[model samples]
Target: MSLVEAEIKPRKSLFVLKTAKTLFGELDALVADQPANSTAARAIVLAHMRETLVAARADAEAELLATSKGIRCAQNLCNAEDEIISAIHLFATKRVYPVDNPSEAETLAVSAVGGYGRGTLAPGSDIDLLFILPYKQTPWGEQVTEYILYMLWDLGQKVGHAVRSVDECLRMARSDMTVRTATLEARFLTGDKTLFDQMVMRFETEIMAKTGPEFIAAKMAERDERHKMMGNTRYVVEPNIKDGKGGLRDLNTLYWIGKYFYQLKTSQQLVGKGVLSAREYRQFQRAEEFLWAVRCNLHFLTGRAEEKLTFDLQPEMAERLGYAKRVGMLGVERFMKRYFLVAKDVGDLTRIFCTSLEFNHAKDMDLVGRVFAPFRRGKVKIKGDADFVIDSGRLNIAKPDVFTKNPVNLIKMFLVAGREELLFHPDAIKQITRSLRLIDSKLRNDPKANNYFLSILTAPQSVERMLRQMNESGVLGKFVPEFGKIVALMQFNMYHHYTVDEHLIRAVGVMAEIANGGLRKELPLTHELLPQAQ
Candidate 1:
């Protein structure tokens, strides 16, 4: 049975754990007996992993049957295996780091990105670490990152899995495996969350500011190297080439293609399915709005769009993108075991370049499946009023798992994270403050208005959030049906009930119907769809 075989996977880990130890011993003996470089090491670790997983499958099944517990049994076994196996790997990984030499970064923060960063590690998953790069902003960032990778390489020589650097993590992050496996499961193993968080901050401030320009340059830089290594503003991520296709990336053309096409593709797909109610479709429209806010790309050089690549593709395309059918989840281990394997990695990456690279045709290409799968899964509950809250702009949030490794998450916790520290940048908040004043300038003279404003001071992301809850429960619709005809589904919330995104759908109707003629235009909450109901 496969390691993922439900009956066997959970219980089988102890046997695998023992085998991993045995293999490490053999590798250690080999290394001790000869020069580390001269020792034949590749077969040693691979053999161990294969043996461990296979034996684990057999053993786990027997144990599960012997100690039959349903429901949480599988989950419990998986956790048990996770405990021992991770312990073993962690011990092995540390030994490779050496007690003798330590890194010199003024601040060293270790973060678990993707799954491990989020405190969820599977039985035999490789641990990911993003070294808080103290030197990234200075000239030292490059050197520091390089040195960190070298250390990881040396460590990898000694152990089955090596610690990956930020670059490696980000590169792999884009890989099919990272998406299916690590994105949801990552958690930090060491270092202060603050330091790791700072690294993200520096990366964003220094990097994303010029993302539009530097991204293009980074792509060009990679083209010289078979388009294997791609860069964003902060770090270089690897793009593995595919079979028979070598050097496939063309940044200039591809960037624009990704920017224009993904949103267009996703929008079209929503319509094509037409499964969602019109109200729900409008909610999806908000997602489309954010897609425009944050751009993602995987543009090719030149090729016609494929039928499989269409946003409206049937269920079969998942397999073409190297996934199971819709019901079949593409988990992280499956990705690492199947596609992110070195040969396939190189082959797939290169295929894009040789594709007579096509622009805006990647709908068939993203191995990650739907970009908003996490949001859709309700894995990360958006705290405030946003139907889907993203970590962008002045405001940000961190899912317990990913906050450490991601730059945006890191920064928010480090610099501006404090309740006291939430002060907006003087220059930046000026315009926003002025707008607030314009909207409520009369509040200064009205004590009641001032009191009411004070009441909602702590609830920045809540106004619309409550409205969303109401909308989801269909409460907004029930409370005010008369305005529904004019506003469709738009509704408002209490404080920001009729305005903003969350409640506006329900509130739009009221604003139009309640206010007579020109008077409707005066209130900031005046929208045809989501107007104030109460």
Candidate 2:
């Protein structure tokens, strides 16, 4: 058995196991007879490896058809690939540079990084890896890394790989946020566990120490940029499920932050620490599972790593996942609706979780919180019961009933927050979620609450930020029942850049900018004609 098969649990199905055993036996025999330095032998090994991989994928797909669970199917696919990679590694190691000590092969540890490292890989996703050398690249380490890459290329696997020594990893991680995040999620696949252990220890101490604030800031910035690129909405009609604003990337970002700051091994740990409510954790799991299923279906259908829920692919995917046409909607629309809902949930969970981090790690979060320092120093306060406190300009509502006791406080919070250009500390947001039931029809129709919400929409500054927070916290939906219908409403076109809610919020933000004369520089014609037009 291969190292991956032996070390990893939940073995492949009997069919797959037998197939792998036979194919691996053949490959092993081939590797044994071929001349170690012969290029011809390398070609033979590559051919056999490719055959084995194709067979493995076929077996996995058959298993998927039987199980019908995306998570299990994906994990099984990864396992099959792991064993295949191991076989190739063993063959490549023997051919490129025969190990004299045998045990000395432990000097080079091969690990999966990024999505592959996460162990829920989408079919045909790039296999990201790290070749961790005990020291700077020696001849043996160089040959081994080169051989692995060459063979993967020959087999036509899209690969992102890095060759680094332990010290080099630390230096790069300390300097680059992207590298740091990837390194933090690295998983040992084969070879030196001892070396992998040392690298992980140094990673925690040398890379993770004193870097929480900077890392969080960088991730947030990256997320904002990504949202901007994806039309700044979770409800894009043809959303990129993996990288879109409120997609799987957002979920992963939450996990990455939790892992980094709290040393969490899994998302469940967040619930245990009270950072995430049990209900919120379920939301996270459902979103993740749904996205994973959609992604896997997309990959299997297209025979590549395709994540975008494009027009043509929608109907088939919907039908595959058991959606059927209804009275007013097509199966495709229903499916897309559910997908957008998942994205929205991911957004909500992210807001709730990050807010917890900000509140709990205030001292460690100063680097990002500095932007709100001036507001914190001011006396701007909103009406709340004894449950409220201002921490670094963010309103923290400690009482669970703060919102229920006065449901208008939900709309009022946004109104006050936008007017003052402040934020709700994460705890307050969590409280708002618990109080969502209080925002029933009576509260929604209260003229005073309605006016307060409008006032928030027209706030001179921070209108967009506050409105987004309201949407994320479920306040907007509960306050305006109509708005709830369009939370993740898809337009099914390219012209509409955002979902209905996002578009509405963005328009309000633009109106606010115009009201403040902030857009005068860009809208010369509007500025010139405003007085006469009015």
For all predicted structures, in order, the TM-scores are: 0.25, 0.84
Candidate 1 per-residue lDDT over residues 346-441, each given as its tens digit: 222222322212212223323333321111111233454222122322222433333222222221221232222232121222222122212222
What is candidate 1's TM-score against the reference?
Answer: 0.25
Which of the numbered candidates is closest to the native, going by highest lDDT?
Answer: 2
Predictions in order: lDDT: 0.31, 0.75
- The whole-model C-alpha lDDT of candidate 2 against the native structure comes to 0.75
Candidate 2 pairs with clashing backbones: none
Model 1 lDDT vs. the true structure? Answer: 0.31
